[model samples]
Target: METFSSIECFVRSAEVGSFAEAARRLSLTPAAVGKSVAKLEARLGVRLFQRSTRSLTLTEAGQLFLREVGSSFNTIQNAVANLASAGGQPAGTLKVSMGTAFGRLFVVPLLGEFLRRYPAINPDWHFDNRQVDLIGQGFDAAIGGGFELPQGVVARKLTVAHRVLVASEGYLQNHAAITEPQDLAHHQGILIRSPQTGRVRSWQLTNRNREHSPLMLKARMTMSDSEADCAAAAQGLGIGLVSMPIAIPFLESGGLQRVLPDWYVDDGNISIYYAEHKLLPGKTRAFVDFIIEQFAEQGLAQRFSAV
Candidate 1:
């Protein structure tokens, strides 16, 4: 009974290599976490950690105990999570909404591994550009930028939505030299038409000195979404302004080169929006944690910074 808490505390401490870190994750004071681990050591009749002022290390016995408890605890948790799962098993359908291009490029691919981890949970995902009413529409979560958050709605930011001007290398070779943000108006531009507002979107580009310049480039084509914007630039239709993530692949392959590489538009942040409630359903919570973990591990947030 009480032993489980001590075991969990010990296991967490070992995994993170610090008692303070384990305490923060468990929502307890560091002293409390240390006491719990001390109790576990007393019961097992062995010193588990070799402690120094600046570092913590596991003893041979501690290593053996951790290997044994960590695996068994996970098995126990998954099993108990079935009947008494408190945001654990995530058995029911997890419904989510996200932008078509972003979902297809990022979130959709993570589904395979997420499903593998929680076999009991089913995913129901919607890929669209329009923002969804999470509560009214019965969606567990939605991912995108610029969604108006009504009362009782919350968001967790995934990444900064920094946008850059890009064009195919071929287009750049033939076009007049583009040296700065204001120079964009002289070239063929691909713009995004807002479906909600029905206006060709405009952006204020900024530099390292925090100075802004408004540029309404002449549009040769107006696309509905970022994928099309990137594709248009890749095809040499025009210089397209879009988020770095959407343009990363083309830029990496040398098909598209950044125009005025030092400048970018601050388009706010991409986030996961969910309805806030006292009790979050297991499925929604699982999906949220999974996505956040994936992002952190892969350094997805840092990938799109100006290069």
Candidate 2:
């Protein structure tokens, strides 16, 4: 489509910062690339670039548009080219972001199978607890818990990231009996700090009866990472309110037991994040589908839930 071609030209020009360089990459003459960009600007009625005799820079609107559409253009190109080729095997680098432990437990194990299926694709994985800027940082995709979605970014949820109270048997045995939500105040609390805001958050625990009970918890040991909170709880530091996925193994192995098993905090859903567009590259699509299917096959939704 001619519109698609115009978008490609504009995005490439913004990326390389020069019409000539973008033209070289797209295998077009500088004049042609410049014309395509001009056509695009005329059609949109916005100047995408601030041009001078020596250099070219994107206008404010151009910068915003590129942030929203640049990565998507890459996806479209890959999809179209792959469709024209033999088998639509996604090739090239897949830059993805994920939570450290979640990726290790649910995603890292499956890397072998994914790479085996698409040998041409190179995986670039960034494992961190904090959220990364998908468009600004040039990331192709991301997997983790709820993050504030930027313009043109969409999410596919993997599972509910339910939070439950957990502690070691030794700690529970030494401390007073925690029969209800209000009783947690008497125990030492191993709490989690917000990764984004760096503030220790307070929450209301919920039960199947739909009661939102307030917890006036004081943290004796505070941590930012979810796994660290679980680890502290396992070490008998105190009761920790943590996501079930990180604590599932410890719970099954008897290293940790549910504290007040009747209640939990509904944090939100863990989701796969990517740019929204009409067409996505086979690599991005493959990874998204593969991760979702793998999670369903493993029954991770129930495993990650407190119910």
Model 2 ranges with Cα > 4 A deviation: 1-87
In order, the Cα lDDT scores of the candidates are: 0.84, 0.86
TM-scores of the candidates are 0.71, 0.80
Per-residue error for 18 in candidate 1, Å, reads: 54
In candidate 2, what are the lDDT values of residues 100-203, reduced to their tens digit?
98889888999999989888888999998899978656677999886888897999998887888999999999989999888987888888888889988888
- What lDDT is reached at residue 204 by model 1? 88
The TM-score of candidate 1 is 0.71
Candidate 1, residue 92: lDDT: 69
For model 1, residues 1-307, the per-residue Cα lDDT tens digits are 7899999889888877889988886789999999999999999999999999888899999999998787677556444544554354568667799998889888888989998888888788999888887865557899998878977689999988888899998899988988877778789999888867879876788877788899768888888898889988899889998878888888888889988888888888899988775556667778888998998998989986664
Least lDDT summed over 10 consecutive residues: which range in candidate 2? 81-90
Span of ten consecutive residues with least summed lDDT in model 1: 77-86
